[model samples]
Target chain A: MTPQSPYALALRQTGDVRDRADFLDQWRELLAEAVDRLLQSGVTGGTPCASPHGPKTDVDAQKTAVLILAALHGGSTLSQLAQDPRPLNAALDLALVSFVAAEDNTAARTGTSSSISKLDL
Target chain B: MTTVDSRSGRRLTARGEKTRAKIVAAAADLIYVQGVGATTLDDVLMASGVSKSQLYHHFAGKDELVRAVIDHVGERIIERERDALGHVSTIPGLRRWRDALVQNNALRHGAYGCALGSLASEVSDQDDAARRAVSQLFIEWQGLLAGVLRRLQDGGALPPEASIDQLATGLMGAVQGGYMLAQTARDVTPMATSIDMALAHIESLSTD
Candidate 1:
């Protein structure tokens, strides 16, 4: 919420360059780690490494996370334009519902929708 | 005596109004190309070819000029989107609107990106006035999308459990994020992919 929030400042750029770069790098790392953690836990389905010959579960998860993040920031764009958070809230639902629905499908294959309620998300 | 506008009580003349519009459009373009922090009044004057006196007559200061630009850009963006937003109640219509946005971005070749969003992320953090304006523009944008979704729901194209507001927000977010990624990477693929995912969610909601 600071005046220097990355994307808001990325284009306008009233802040230090090194600071902005550092913040962005940190953000990427955080998102990557978060996705990896989720995949490793199987909460998002599939192992973090999955298999050497199989789809790179971590990479796939990170991609999805980034897409979800983009939708979110886009939602914020809409929210800012509208001056209301309702659309942003709707976007959160949009990403999560689709996500949870997919996860439920995977979990259903494993005979356990039980973990769906476990995640605070 | 200073003249007063009947609507907003601002002193202005017909020529002054035209001059102001010209200046605002020039300023918006310049600001879009160069960030507001970097685009000066002199640059605006040079780009717009409007005399310094006229600029001063219409706007008290740089901040005033920037505010005017914000309003001008807001109006212009909404105007451009009006067609797709209105009278849309079918699933195909939603796809058309989404595709049109993607096509518009593609036409730009992923350069400069969204007119409003380009300014939004930059100014949203810069000043209180700019922040408020950006926020209001997004709200307006979301309302337009939500209105169409609501119509679809009423027509039973969307399930009764569907929330128009959320779908609209999610759909808008996808575009916003897509623009950001596409602009930063100088690629249109992300924008297209993001729109697809967003639309896919909407498609999933459709009874048809």
Candidate 2:
């Protein structure tokens, strides 16, 4: 981690920029701030991702980390209140277990790739 | 919602708790990897090493089992955060937390979105119980983050006018969105970029 991780620093510095049309929306700005805060906060628990069936995978922790960050940074159809990143932590527990169970060493690198295929906007 | 029979003092039997835990652990694994819609009671049974009759006894049905898994996930996740955040109250502490996240995500190259979001997208519409369980988890998590934000505020780490509730909500959304974008894009850039931007904006508030 850099002395001042760029994202965390960004989250700490807040402003309502009125001039820029690209980054002026409240929701967008809020998301940026939250991401920054999350980056600074780091992941709370060292809780490893569970992959019930598969051998222990290094991706387990990474999976949990990304999922939680995604929840905090991503948008949802639910109410804004429901959109809080905190849910990411809860979701990470579930994901960790699943990852442990389904550890596919061969396709580990591709997991992210697969997600990208499905997630493209 | 089923009423808890408080008057009757109905509680999970020791056998029931063991059975319930197995089922939840199995379900948590299967649903997250296979997608909730793709997973089945049979899968849960096979993974959990529980018999059909035992599964039914522990849970009224599959929906109930999913709810149980959600609860289990919520408990585990909440415990993890409480432990991590409890370690420190300084800016450096917060940085450690963020470092953990980035390091973890970078490990897998940013694959897989959140389990809760996965369920929310796949099963929320089909299962009322699942929706409620997932929703409850979100509420609890938000409360936890808000508490942390409150601490930051009290320390004057955050601006006096900062809204903890809003900040918590925003943080949650960005994480979710970043995952979605990352999954779709097949790249970690979206996740990394989103977080960086979010952090920059958050720090802006501290300047005041």
Candidate 3:
């Protein structure tokens, strides 16, 4: 069933072990990885927040991924609580807006398209 | 009408009322830290310094006492917060309410999740009565937010076509899910970020 289903969403917070296991299977590592990427980035995309010594990962592409990840779990919880899907829509909108804004800002500043701007999302 | 259970202490003497309140306060604290299933009746008795019979006299069983703890959480934590939500249509008011919630969790050192939401997670599926109580509390909260958003819509601060209930629900999810994320991350920033995103969503809906 889709995460938009009220039952699936509410269960994320208080569901049984199996239900939790299922949710984790789908989104757990993804969120962690995305969050890690966000933590490294300047988030504003101005300073290049990626550390100098850490393994070279694409912080730019991960920006959109992070927004998408945040929207999914955050959207699931909000949709369930409101008993409506509109919040999810708002969240997804916020995600895209965040990424696209970042992309534009980066491209304007550097006079070159940023990695996040290349993403199809 | 659903009968109000006597375990509510409505029929108690002054001294009995004091004892009942004491028990509930103790249970609320323990349950806040330990969770419902982990906290036993003995934990309440020991924590409150009440006798076994006194515990029973005050509550028919653990479930009754748990319901009371839920009420205590509602009164002590949520009601005060709800009053703040009444002004959520305005920008500054929403920030005040959001800051208070995040600060309260930070004060707990980010140990237990939201008192109500944590209790909710433990009992949402395990106990029907308790689950309904938690659900009602959330509804009250969501309603408070919806009330403000509806007012905003009417005032043309927000788009009339925007579904206020859905907006409120999504905001509540941000708060609730942020609590869980902050709890796991052992940092308050996640909660703050979630709330920030939600408020931004409202701004996106605003006509201004």
Candidate 2: lDDT of A12?
A: 19
Report the Cα lDDT for residue B16, model 1: 66
TM-score of each: 0.74, 0.59, 0.70
Ranking by TM-score: 1, 3, 2
- Candidate 2 chain B, which ten residues in sequence have the lowest lDDT sum? B1-10
Say which candidate scores most in TM-score.
Answer: 1
- lDDT (tens digit, per residue) of candidate 3 on B61-111: 889889989888987666686678766667667777888888988986565
The backbone clash count of each candidate, in order, is 12, 68, 0
Deviating ranges (above 4 Å) for candidate 1: A1-42, A45-66, A76-89, A102-121, B1-11
Residue A70 of model 3, lDDT score: 49
- Model 3 stretches astray by more than 4 angstroms: A1-121, B1-5, B8-10
Give the range of the ten consecutive residues with the poorest summed lDDT in model 1 chain B. Answer: B1-10
Candidate 1 backbone clash number: 12
DockQ of every model listed?
0.31, 0.11, 0.13
Give me the candidate number with maximum lDDT: 1
- Look at candidate 3 and give me any clashing residue pairs: none
Local accuracy of candidate 1 as per-residue lDDT tens digits, B1-208: 3445323567777776778778888999998776677899999999999999888877788887888878888888887778777878877887888788888888776766787787776665457777787778877887888898788878987777665655676677778877866665556777877777667667766666
Model 3 lDDT per residue over A28-103, tens place = 4674566556545645443454546553243334333434444555555444444445545544544444434444
